[model samples]
Target: LEFLQKPWHNGRLLRSKGYFWLASRHLEIGLLAQSGKQFQWDYVGRWWNFIEPSQWPRDEYRLQGIMAKWDSVVGDCRQELVFIGQGLDTRVLQRELDHCLLSAQEIAAGPLAWQALPAATAFDTEALSARPTPPMAVQPT
Candidate 1:
């Protein structure tokens, strides 16, 4: 919402989807699926970085790839998304999205503190509603 404040006048954003790390959920990976105005954030899984290395892939090459993406502070956690559109102002989009990210202070406060905030995330609500609930069985008289 913050990233796309104004609708595109010259071009349209066709699609955007990817896995990203949220400062609020430091260990979990979030999948952002977007098509036009409708977009959803779903929990993908926990970041490999947070798990024990013994549970990691046995392949050395795969391990190397993961390590390569690792950051000194956040490890492999990062914001990775793809945007496809025509005549897009990428610079402006990037800047706006960056602004939506948590500040240094917020990030430093850590996930525990983030969880303490009331209604701090919309993902949980949206995800729950998106699920298909099963109908209750009725007893025959």
Candidate 2:
């Protein structure tokens, strides 16, 4: 009976269709990708329709939502923004490809990385300045 209280508050009034989830997901990454998180390969695929040339509607809709949000924030500059959107799209596609190429099962079945194991990354800080700075001599000492 409480559902009658407000049309906006009810979960039933809300939708369950997961197609729109991309829009929300896109918002989180689109801006970051545009800002230079270019190597992100994690968000490449949400559906298993990779063999098809057609894009998933959710993916398309997600990009549109990203564009919409970008437009709202930076308006009246169509030409420049279109180029930016294209760049973003390219980055996202590259990420998907990278993810696919890295997974070995996708390569054979266990995931691509599992098949051709990549070398572990070195985390040493040898690149940083190791020389210790001498304390400035006391003014009058």
Candidate number with greatest lDDT? 1
Q: Lowest summed lDDT over 10 consecutive residues: which window, candidate 2? A: 119-128
Best by TM-score: 1
What tens-digit string does per-residue lDDT give for candidate 1 at 1-141? 334445666467899988766655556676778998797776666777677778777798877778877888776778888989988898877886787787778778888887654334554455457754322211111
Listed per model in order, the count of residue pairs whose N, CA or C atoms clash below 3 Å is 1, 11
What does the lDDT read for residue 64 in candidate 2? 59
RMSD of each: 9.3, 25.0
Superposed Cα deviation of residue 87, candidate 1 (Å)? 1.6
> Compared with the true structure, what per-residue lDDT tens digits does model 2 show for residues 51-111?
2224323476654543453344322111111122322345553453244232333335432
- TM-score for each model: 0.74, 0.17
